[model samples]
Target: MAQFDEVFDWVVVGSGAGSMASALLMKQAGKSVVILEKAQWVGGTTCKSGGVMWIPANRFMNPGEDSLEQACRYLDAVVPDGPDSPGTSPARRRTYAVEAPKMLDFIVGQGVKMERGSTFWPDYYDELPGGVKTSRTVTALPFDKNELGKDWASKLRQGFLEVPVRLDDGMKLPFMKHSWKIKRIFLKIALKFVAGKLTGKHWVTAGAALQGRMLKAVLDRKAAEIRTGSPVSELIMDGDRSVGVITARDGRPWRVGARLGILINAGGFAMNQAMRDRYMPGTQAKWSNGIETDTGDMHIELAAKGAQLAQMDQMVGFQMSEAPGWDTDYVKPGTQSTTGKPHAIQVDQTGVRYMNEGGSYEEFCENMLVRNRTVPAIPSWAIMDQQYMDEYGVAGKGTAKKNMEKWLASGWMRRAETVEALAALIGVPPAALGGAVARWNGFVRSGRDEDFHRGERAYDNWLGDPFFKNGPNQCMGTIEKAPFYAIPIVPGDVGTYGGVVCDCDSRVLREDGRPIPGLYACGVTTASPMGRVYPGAGASVGPSMTFGWIAARHAAGLGNQFG
Candidate 1:
């Protein structure tokens, strides 16, 4: 039997960007800290993400140009207009404003290289009121794969690594071409990748980059350490204040004490069936909201000890393909929305358009459920024309044929010559389906989709190869093109957005809305600062990184002292 280690000043759970940042920050604050990550590999879901941190007035980008007041004003436009919302809660919003700069300073000043890769990636609703088009997105300087060294390689998940696969497979060509003019000003990502290899530049992806960057700073300083495959089974409670965690690894069970604080940066339930069924009852998912291991029990366990939970009902559900991860994702890249692609219109159970095809994840989800409340959801179909198949090449070859064949052969998709005939085959009321397409066509012709505003956002217009030079725009083929196609669309999500709420100090909150003693949480375990609107190009990662730094530093008692 392995002997249990005694105690550290702080202990963190989960290895995602937020949790890792916490561990790193705590260590920098001169407190002994240990990170217990459930993943065999480190980076968590962050490694699998696009790695953008939407920090307003961050030190790296528009340094000396941005301020807290400006960030708040920009946020005022989008943060849900209500009490009990992220924007409405002064304390929670303040938490982000105060610590965001510190997090950026600590991580970047420590040598985590960064660049503005998203000159073209606009806000989710850039064209909407109060949306800003530029300056919010940031990316890691291109990283050399060789720079991770051997220790980090096997631990990296392959699923999140697919972007490189597509790049290497010549998909980058289409991304930079006349047909795919999605980006007007390319960050030169492909060139950067090539240069990174040659120049020995090592970079992080999405939130993982932020997490990894922070971890590197602390590890170099030897302030904290992370132990993979160590899962905290229970909290070490000492008279109402949690003291340590009982972690099990390699068949050995033991307790690792936390002298000062224990923060659960573990993620939320996009993967766990119970939490998914409870919080987001209608969402269909196969992978995770963040990670497959992000079971909701961490809160349950803490709650057993009287830790109050907040916003258990809210989750970040985006539109995912019918097949979920990997195989399904091949039909469309993660960055692209389900709308205006080589598919059919997305309708709810009542067979009516519920959202703009180019909307963000949360709005997409909120609207989906709102529509579902009024109707019984049969699968929504993606109606495609044979001309669409031949001309556009069905999701650019290979992927389209494979998934569509599987769907058609499996009866999930049907094809016919007319929109009415195609709708009849799927049982979605031929007239309703016909009218929907006609309305959609009218929107396409006038270059104005009045119903749902298909090409409203700059992001959407860029993705569709619309004939007009109107940025990324979409058009319908009039099913008049014949040999129309349709596939069932079911609403799904990446994960939930709520958990143990915390303040800028990274302190967990009590039932009375007080920061709980010696406890903190980041990642999906806390209230998302985006306040129901995803602003950052990689919105999820920004808060995760910022909060991770906050939680870790505060837990290690370094919140005030760190440089």
Candidate 2:
């Protein structure tokens, strides 16, 4: 019923992983599709991420290691099932478990190269029932951006890593100073760099590689029409059914109609200070590492049309330290390495150890926010000794004389000769600080964290020093050396977690549980199907792409192929 300047079988908003996947599926079905991106760049916040997809029972996994049944059990154990977590119902979880691998296979069939992530990258809750000790994650190999051609390559969003290092290699790079295995990995990376230069290939890794490969495939097929800087301002509703959208083109409003449905893959509101204050209070937008365009415009539009929004307060928390220039850096230096490494422990303002330091980034920041409700733990202090500074350094930077002097001068880090003096500098009670340090030291001696069980999980040890010889537990080491240091750690996030809720088929649902016909959504634009818990690495991206694929299939009259 809406007048249109253009029409397509499917129209996707936001050119993220979900958008790309959905468009690819539509193309495979010979349906006309258009992808509209608000930013000048094509990839969304996904481009700035570590492009990992947690696909359980994927084809690349070793036989007998994973299955759909086990994956469902793991989801049942970890993801909450209640009114508050409606996005992660048993049915939806089952669908995700079953269809995720199919999505991976489809992408691979389309010529995007993918491989299993590190075998050591265990699930975040691997100790739980149905959890795997080894990785179930999938990632794209390092891609040559030249494959996309110069025009498309220039429009692709840049990621944190430009070198051709795999995600596992990047993870191990931090330990190069300690382990011979890491040194060999470094040598291989050096060879890769030389090889790339000689071959005249501009290689990219991480998120960029994943997206670059997908984009190249899409262009090669020439099926979906992709447009950038086209922001969808309104969802054109034909009496409750989303029939089209009002987007900008040529500096004017353009009406685009979809014969099947409009999929909203727009990102979350991590960069919007107002939304952050309303949903997740005590968090600052400046601390978030999400893309600048993730301002939640589509979320507001969807809610205005009676769509149910849930889990508004949840975020994929990435704990960060306020290093010099952290506010302006493309990728803020994270404290996950700092707290999880040896000779370091996080304490509250009252100078007391609260939670396990070597847990997942989501839990790390969630614990900090929850602790802030009673105690002043928003900016928790990470207490470390000279040994930690000498070995692991602080916030991913080497603790050279110049770096330490700069940090000290800028008030980003505090240092002292004794625990008492360091406590005073960081505004903590001296007795409490010294007592906490002594307690931690005692745990190191016994090789057991009786207070919080820091090193009990394989994940904890994976994040710690693998070659630590002095300590029985990889994450347990005495913080007793001289020249103690303290740095403030805050609850930073990759993106917000809450948005309009969707069903198993990726249809946007209203408050009364009825689907809004001709409407679908994926990515952070929808409330996460994993509920409030992060299952493993790439949880967000895996679901986003899978649901996107599901949406396209359903629109094309193919109902739940895997189901």
Candidate 3:
């Protein structure tokens, strides 16, 4: 290992998508780069995710499916200029719009095999301008972990799926549409696993695959080094210009100089309660599903050094609940049962519906905050009938349920024979819930959501149970079946979107709007380019890595117009 005092071309902080992308590019430019990770693992929360990159106009997109003009239109429509958000500006949009395809091509050319995401998977807002039904999202190919050797492979962050199958394989399974064919797929998977074990080949999927490929690319270059369990405590400034970082590793502080620049790719502040309370006010860290390593360490440390911030109230909102049996440190994202399915509705403490039930998780949580201003809507309840439990199942419980006694006994789920009784158990007014259900039933019968248009959009139906035998409105169903259930849901976020503001070149800006020389930032450590709205799946990582690449190129004295 080299001494910490040695000067490198670049010192990148945080070993997430942004960090590795920046480090790889800098190394490609014939510069030395070192990556620092706070956790014992690399990859950060990206490894726990689906590892899809939403790169519009990439090689994978079908002809005419995407264009810069349409993409700009979509950005304008989705993240419009307002008091809350400046919207995604044309300059930033153009930067990402052009660089995304190039970034995808560059990484793929470097040995990262990518597959187009689900053909049936629509953009989160498919009906919005420039939105496509498919091909904008690309996922990494499954990688054999054994290729990296056991010890180094085990250091990578593990995916959330405990199964051996990749996300594509899991999504392609016949269990949903063709249940009879599931046995064949299961048998094939079992045989493949057996064969792999016999051959000492261990395959990892999703985020692990993405990180493995990227790490392998870095290692192949032999010019980049990643140090885990190394937390960069402060930026070492030379006059007004950022020069280096002081990292605390193994109980000792060391000064590592960066001759070119330092890129802060540290993650969001979702796990930092004090930051959440201060910046986000009503939101709490306990409700966020973001990685625990994201404690606003970089944001706090850098803000004290005169870094300007923007969109501090924004977050990548989602619906989630406290993960059962896990420590009190985090919340598990809950998606299926509450929204997109029939026979269920999310309601405030007073049992009133506030928003369309089948909307995106981000929209759902945003509405939660809107209602929380004057009502107890932060921790609302997902009220559903036994039909929902039988058809879609409850949160934390899989689609197949052997018994509901344990869930009900644990008090995490409340069961009652009637809606009124359920409301009583959960402390909501009986009439309000009963009326809401009646209105919901009317909407179901008419194949129209008069109050809240749950099934109006293509994205809404995409999240619905396709096999559900309903009318044209797939997300609608009567909640008349007895033995209703209610589970508490809260405002949850995957990550925060606000931090130090950076220019299109990925240079961090000061309060005076001038670039801070030698200091660059990307990922959640900087305010996102998408502003207040998440465009689609992989929105976070797509911009994070793109800006990272941009930052690396710019710091190397390369032009801002990078391919």
Candidate 4:
């Protein structure tokens, strides 16, 4: 409601994880920066994620002790040059390959912490180039809610699970906690629910914890501020070198100048149906976990300022619960990120395995399109067994139970005490459904999935619990545990990765492949490094934050040279 103007050294738009990380780091470097967010809240979809930050060769990762090199080998074997990749040109990916450590070091050195998992999880398609079994995945130790300086911790957003306090570096929460009854769950959640009221040893949820910690550092900077409810309508370009942005901060327009560059950390086009129709047609918006503010306005506003778009046809799609009130259906209860493991099998309309059932969200969609004869890709079921659901608590037991009830009540759930009856309702022939289950059961009984090899890799079994049967035991759950239930599975996504083209340094390129001065983009707003592929856990956030820091550093004139 206030109309005023001020100039800063840099302007970062969209205060999501990417923007917040960039702004915090930029301010750490003594650059005067301002972050603008269109949403009423600051964290965006990140606050709702599972909260794991995947970084290879990170502090907790043991290259000599654990062998991250094996994983890198897997990734190189799988990850090709993503199309419209601005920075990952053979040169950029290679450069980024080397710089990743230092870039990581910069954040860690600046106070962002990290903790590597015992083993890294693959990005669904562990069989692909550059894909590895484990080690690059990491999490941050949880922050005490009290450490957030009261006001910061009190009113912040909440994730689905009760996050555990971690010890060590920057990585945060990784999975959802389940198995407890809904009452115990809610009681524990109630304590966290009144997060504002509790004081003792409070732990931060991953996405929010990560962002909040980063925000704490950002707010500490002199002349740096987080401006939410600010949506940039126009670029204040003096010629081509983007000088500032004219934004609407709570319906009041204000001009904030950027001395060096205006960073478009505003995220991607997942929430924008118009942009979805324009580039990634047939893609559903509700599947994405990206910021609600990421509706392509920043892309259009930036393009009007001379930024070219890239990777506009692909998105980071995942199989989400088609449950009501599940806007993006975040699989990570307390965190805003998914572990991205291929625990679920995506079958075609014929109930046949289509593509690699465990492909990354992006790869899943692209493969579906490439294999479009597999009609009904959009509404496909991510088939799983009752045992698997009971063990990991992924999607959480309470949410799943309620969701099952809702589905059963709304007729979304196809329930039959027998697999054959369920197949009839789902239209999958009794023989086919019964046969698939029988084969799957055989895999469970034999402890081997000869056909799909679901748990062949250590990554696929990440969700498996110790109590599960060993050998034929691994994650193989019997579908025979009736009443056999099938909640309608819908395609979900972290967000869309189709937007403006940018180089590795996060500078947007025009159609002519030259940098659009004063304009830089990262996160979903810029082309992703994996393109239509997800390399592993923390895939989108890894590049989004890494490149976001890269872009902010570049805008500050501290990073590498631009061609």
Candidate 5:
């Protein structure tokens, strides 16, 4: 038995989407719950994210378009099996495929509104078996933070987009310069912004919308307590079972007990340089966009208590370029959306065009790290031409004179009159770069990428210039326009993908394959159920919230509601 200053039916560490979901479920079950957040704000990294949840066969999807069998097949094809991918064992994968939709239904039943993502938002590998060209992604509608009241709204973590825009709006906003449809969408968003201001509604979109709605739902119940700036330092153990945790209150050590279980939704170690060096080498913490509170303190505490940690090397890579103010920005400008656009290509330090520039961000950065094993490619260069500058711009910035000068002055961007001169500026062999450009131009003319199959998938085309008039292929365009430019791209991550291993029930598991009683975990705190593969949008948040639901149900003795 452990001494405690307070007790609850459920104690959740971290105020992420998963933590909030579990706390909500516990409260609904008539159990007392508390959420302890290390950060001063609620909503964790999920609030700072795009807030898309990948739920196959969701209610919003057309009936018969997706099913458990189909989703399982897709998972089987993409997520690797065997001991190497122990986190995504056959049983766990099946459980996720089945329970994900149920989780969505449960969340919605609790009054968290959601709708399907873009119809054009295809799976990364749509050509694969069981893959859907239509989206399985679900996202919350834009929410008004004013509903949360001033104090609670002030405590909510801010996201990238302040204005209320749908997730699909983000997909189309990049092409406002090209398409009439995008321009109309932009006009609508602007009008909505004005109307919202007049109505005294402070709207927020993306992750903030999802989290704001959830936070409102949680607070509306008024059954669960949420404490910020309270970090769970250590777990209180009785024999092999976790009974409580040691956290802080009023700058003093405070002990809190859990009558049911303690759930660790405390996120990953993307901000911990020591852990990054040990697990994911050739990566820097500064490049990561994970929230500052994601220092993996819970991971260390879990490991110290004999929890088995696996797949620690994997990260949810979101390839990024060093923009003028990248270091200080809330969400760094990423090159993932830019490198795949027209009139641009990615190459190693030796000026050789490598993997396909378009696809999932995880695969993009995985290829970068893998290529670095053979070539000096850690800081790969994204080579572009004046046409790209004229149309697509660089790292989400316009090609205005001021923006260009600012980038050039900061050395974050380089430009030259010729391809060879550009290569020289970026420290690559001029001849090799020139040859690569010539080869890419030839491919654009032939409409085929013999080297890496650049734009064969629906996803690749989605990341491309839809309004490109000169090329037959949306992703393939001549990089020959004068005043060539180069921007160095690194394998930046949204969050690390690996941590302590858990079972299908979301119970923390030991090396011997036994569950640590009263210990549950979800989100990035555990090795992800997707294994090394990023299936589609919201893969991380989807599993995190689903498993959090599962953990709560198991703790409450609900006995697998989906089962």
Candidate 6:
């Protein structure tokens, strides 16, 4: 007896950072909005992230000497404009440079807690032109779940850590600290958890906190609705204009009409094998860390409806290693190679070192792709001495001896008494491995990596063992210990970078370079604003939320107006 079809002023396809931000902005503009999430939970892969937003000249942080001009200069040096990568367009760049700070201020004004993340977080490539040593990234402040009520708060995504910790607290303290400082920090975190439990004040941090606050705003506004377990299968069109979406719920199709526009923010094609095979070469969809639900349904359906695609061959990547307890089938989502630690060196299949081991995850995967063109660079081996293993642990796991025993017994890692023996076990030539180790040890003695300049950059030093301060080279340490180990690593990606092309206003474009009315996109559904390069921490989420905000205002016919 009830109507199977519904109508709203705006409908968002996904409930990630982009979709949530868009929904909130539209609600603030007095628009009736609804969100469609395929999964039962609200957060996507963003829940697994650090939830930092890289906004240059943001008012939330002390901008110091950073300005729109400096930000543009940095972007120009890193992200080049091209037909395939429209992220570097002057109009889009300027829009992002100016509107990003405003977007941040707007969200923070909506009861979303925030703090400066640049004091300790370094830029990914601070040595580059227009790059600063700090103060461009902001992170979500921890939230108490009691404020949202139990039933409503339960819908939020669970964090990856046992205790609530901010991005800078989680990233900097554990990986870079003295033993005493690390212990003290852990104790402080433990005490906070105890106090919270006693006070019935449950807290969540990182991406969960970020999405939770946005979700709270949506509910607080009371002008929006969220429908989970509703997978949008297609878009409904009136002539050439997108009017709504056709979603599948409870094994039935329902048409949800939008009066203004339908914004598609349902992530990228990272989990679609067919798209992966067609776009990314020498890489498979299984290697992506994106959520399994992110299979490009919106992208495929929209592309069929005449939306133009761009930057399909690029991804935000990392160097990932697998352990026995980990999800080897898909490689763990946050798996990272422990390359910057002392006495550890990454080598190609030929037992030859390819790049600076102390580089960022994006840099690591970029170099791996370049090497894959001519040689078998993926599944590279990370060789480390027992001293390094004992000090910094192996891969991205902890440094406990019990963990080491479990890894060794389960065959998750290969170990030997000497470098030559370890090389033999890992199918690397003994002589080649020996020579690489000798050269690395020589660099350690001189405190200089003439071959690759591993510890030359401040960003590199930030990732290195902070306790090991030997002149300017904290990343270098002699691998002369008795026992050695080798771990197999492969090129892993966080998410695909390619999607439909959009203009500065975030309107999806046709194949002939014209904007399609009433059809907009944000997040990974649109081509990245940073092109193929990641400028700094939270680059993906930052632009995703900003553009999402932009898309809603544009649909409301107030694109030119700002508060």
Best candidate according to lDDT: 2
Off by over 4 Å in 1: 1-4, 60-67, 81-88, 127-130, 162-173, 176-218, 287-289, 323-336, 341-344, 386-407, 410-412, 462-480, 556-563
Encode model 5's per-residue lDDT on 443-552: one tens digit a residue.
98999888988888888888887777787777888998798999999999999999989999999999999999999999999899999889999999999999999999
Give the Å error, residue 461, model 4: 1.5
Distance from true location, Cα of 560 in model 4, Å: 6.9
Q: TM-score of each candidate?
A: 0.85, 0.98, 0.94, 0.83, 0.98, 0.94
Per-residue lDDT of 1-563 in model 6, one digit per residue for the tens?
A: 22328889999888888787787788778889989998887877676566778899887656366888888878777777877687448778778988998888888878777888758556777788888677688888777766778876777766555366666676656554467766676778778889999998878887777887777877887747888889998888777888888897678999888888988888888888888888877766666778778788888898988998888888888667766645753336333437877778888888899888876677688788889788777888888887777677565667747587888888768989988998889888899989999998988888899899888877777777777754456678888887888888877787888899898889999989898889999888888878878888888889999998899889998855654
List, in order, the clash count of every candidate structure.
21, 0, 0, 45, 0, 0
Error of 3 at 529 (Å): 0.5
User: For model 4, how does the per-residue alpha-carbon lDDT over 1-563 read when each residue is reduced to its tens digit?
Assistant: 21238888878887666776677667666778877777766666666555566566666665463334544554556556644454345545544455555566766665766656445454466556555555576655555555666776654556543344342211212222423343454455456547644646566656766666666656655425766667878787666677788888656778888877888877777788888878876767766666557688887887776677777877777655555445444442211111222223445556665543433455555766555543665555445555434433333324354356665676655667787787677776677667776776676667677886666655555534333444543344555566565544445567776677777777888878888787887777777666555666777666777777788777777745211
Candidate 2 vs candidate 6: the TM-score winner is: 2
How many clashes would you count in candidate 4?
45
Q: What is the C-alpha lDDT profile of model 2 across 412-448, one tens digit per residue?
A: 8899999999999999999999999999999999999
Off by over 4 Å in 5: 400-402, 560-563
Query: Over 4 Å off in model 2, which ranges?
Result: 560-563
**Sequence-dependent TM-score of model 2:** 0.98
Off by over 4 Å in 4: 1-5, 63-75, 82-87, 117-132, 149-157, 160-202, 249-251, 324-346, 355-359, 365-373, 382-407, 442-447, 478-483, 559-563
The lDDT values for all models are 0.61, 0.91, 0.79, 0.61, 0.90, 0.79
Q: Please provide the root mean square deviation of candidate 3 (C-alpha atoms, Å).
A: 2.6
- Lowest lDDT sum, 10 consecutive residues, model 4, at 332-341
RMSD of each: 4.4, 1.3, 2.6, 5.2, 1.3, 2.5
Cα lDDT tens digits, model 1, 1-563, are 21346778888887776765665566556678777887787776666665667776666555555578766665666676554553225555656766776776776766777766545555677765545565566666434333446675445543343322221222334434454443432445556557666776554354445445545655667756778888778877666567778888668876888777887877776667777677667665562335667677687776776666666666665454444233454122232333555334676544566566565656665666667766765345556666555544332223445466665676645788888887778777877877887776666566676877766676565445535342235533344477787655555555677776566666776766666677777777776666666654666777787777776665555537664
Ranked by lDDT, the better of candidates 1 and 6 is 6
lDDT of 3: 0.79
Clash pairs (backbone) in predicted model 6: none
